[model samples]
Target: MTNFRIWAVGCIASFFLLGVSLAFISMNDQTQTTSGTDDLYEEIISNKAKYEKPAENAVIDKVWKKTPGIEGRAVDVQASYNKMKKDGVFNEKMLVYKRVKPDISLEDLPSSPIYRGHPDKNMVALLINVSWGEEYIPDMVKIFSKYHVKATFFIDGAFASKHKELVQMIEDEGHTIGSHGYLHKDMAQMSENQAEINMEKANEVLYALTNKKVKWLAPPSGSFTMNTVIAADKLGMETILWTVDTIDWKQPTKQVLLQRVLGKVHNGATILMHPTQVTVDSLPELIEQLKKNYRIGSVPTLLSENR
Candidate 1:
């Protein structure tokens, strides 16, 4: 009878183990099925949300309007236009803003430096100040062309006046030319008439050299005044500021200069660099890293695209 009781106890234990195993298997199966269903439901919800979101109809409308000289309007165009108008295109204000008074002072210009961090896939523009080292102009052009990046060069009228051929070469290479002023004077201390004279002198030289209107201006020593801006604008110029100051004028080490520019560049940034040996040494690396981290575009392109 004791042996029989032992056998019966063993059978009961076996049965209990089997029951636990079966329960675990059932739970796991149910969990897997639930997880799969949840995944599918999430995908469906995401797609639904994507479809329900508003379309960029305004952008489409603008593109259509700007596309000039289309023959007859097609059904597709009308549909697209109507959809855009419904999507808040027609509701936008058509009023134009009055021109901002050109009252920025030379003192208002950035003297120390301006940089959030060197561009890392966020830098928008490079503001190049071209003066000195005219012998290296061709090499500079080649370097820019090799990297397929265009830069704005603030040419000193004195330099530009002497190197009309080089000035034309700069323009022929599809780069924007701007006035660095006739003699690189501080615009803040100058009278309004003097400022105007300075700008006119630079404009005359640049215009004569490149046969292109000088539309941008960068003050020497980053100095300027309300009168300066007014003078520039009166002569059809726009004031530009640097987001990254190279301090190449200070003759910093190439590594140090590279670090400063690489560490502080960001989108909508304007880099201030001079045509110096240190800058020349850093150019290859700067261009490579900038291309890797951000989209390198000409200053004019950046302004036009952003504006």
Candidate 2:
């Protein structure tokens, strides 16, 4: 009975020792796994830190150095680059290093009379018809001078011949002189030959007075046929029409004239008026109001800027 009792005690001690050894082995394996996981996590963090910041900085520096021109446009280019980078599409094809020329030319344009200057420019032109009202021109000139604005005056050939001094005065004041057709007749009613004759007649007189070639023609009463355009084109002149007409010739009140102009005026507007009392009186206010929203200049000046 004593020997059996001793054998039971020995078996119990061996079982406890085996259990402790297994527990220690299990803990060591678990510790080794945790340490391996920690090393891999630290390596991942270190690699990200080494590469991420410099990659972002490289992208920004490359985009900024390639963009040109005004700072505003450069900012736009950078924003586009940043967006492209976010999409993983940033490449050399996105850069613009030079000014691109337009693919269109004058011949590519539609064959219609120019009713306004370039639509891209925030500008308006005043086209004054000088068919009759010679007496009021000086006052109009004074008002234009006061506002520091230049206009294009389409002069009747007969009126221009009779009033060369006024034509010279208009020219000296830095205003443009265009043909209003000879005899102030409707160009649409005339033959091509007659149209050419009339345009040449007006051109001769204006050239004699201003010593500058006439480059624009406004058909009398805004009446023109295709022949009129052809005739003007043959003479190296472009036909111009008004986008906004004041109709001061109908002798409207100053308020009516002002309303007609202000209501329709916009960027690239070619405003038509005549040398009349109402137009002369309304000129100052019209110019002052338009200057707030538009750059007032001659047709050529505004058109060239747009090109």
Candidate 3:
């Protein structure tokens, strides 16, 4: 009985010693980790300015009219530190690049024709005006899908009503739909009331189909007057023009289509195109090349103030 009691006591003492040692080791590791974290955060804060950038505000240009603002970036020290803490390691990949907004947004600018996005915004938009080429649209949508790109399609009102399935397909593929007028008439010749009626009629047809109010209008054949602009603005839509014209309606060669767009491409450039054979053939290569340097986006995304 005495021998058993001695052995039991020895085992209990050993267990207590082991527990204390483990607790000390744990405390020491925790202290070291905390110290490392503090050092890391301090380092990041010190070097924050090297990576920080200022935001560019939207401005009204004498020639371009309303221009979009490019979002800037800044290192968020506290947020980054917390992220590192949660991750339990120092990782450059985990650093948070928070967006710095501009003082003047797109909405702050006066209502006018938007010809291009902000020059500082490293992005491009493909503006597809759909009127006649019902056959080529499927292939164009296919190419866009294959490249994982989204484009803005300014659909004609009559076309939208007649080809609801095609419009739905384009919409389903995550493309933005806008207005292209009802009769494809010259807005330059129409009076304010005439233009307003035409636009309203188009909007009605589009709304019935998409169930969403149209926010953009591309006047047919690039014909518009201030009266047209005023009418569109009154109807709560912005008139959009393109920076680059593919001239696909003229049936340029595939190489010509590519060069016409890629050659003159710049930040905030809106490439206007129609549903033509040249576009369908050049879209694949054009998108692949454009993706190498620029972020291809929809019109709404290109014009947005957000990062």
User: So what's the TM-score on candidate 2?
Assistant: 0.67
Worst 10 residues of 3 by lDDT: 86-95
User: Best candidate per TM-score, number?
Assistant: 3
Per-model TM-score, in order, reads 0.62, 0.67, 0.83
Ranking by lDDT: 3, 2, 1
What does candidate 3's lDDT look like per residue over 1-307, in tens digits? Answer: 9999999999999999999999999999999988878887887788778777789899888999888887889998888888888666666676788999899987776668899988877889999988789999999999999989999999988888889999889888988999999868899999989999999999998888777899999999889998998899889899999999999999989998899998999988999999998889889889999999999999998998766
Model 2, runs deviating above 4 Å? 1-100, 107-111, 305-307
User: What lDDT score belongs to each candidate, Candidate 1 first?
Assistant: 0.66, 0.76, 0.89
Off by over 4 Å in 1: 1-123
Kindly list the per-residue Cα lDDT of model 1 for residues 1-307, writing each as its tens digit.
9999999999999999999999999999999866755554444334333223121111112211110011111123233333443333321132112222223322233222222222222446766676577877777788888888888888989988778888888899998888898777888899878988988898888888777888878888778766776777667566766667889879999899999988987765678887777887888899998887687766665544121
Per-residue alpha-carbon lDDT of candidate 2 for residues 257-276, written as tens digits (9 for 90 to 100): 99999999876788999999
Model 3 local distance difference test score: 0.89
Query: Which segments of candidate 3 are over 4 A away from where they belong?
Result: 1-38, 84-92
Error of 3 at 208 (Å): 0.8
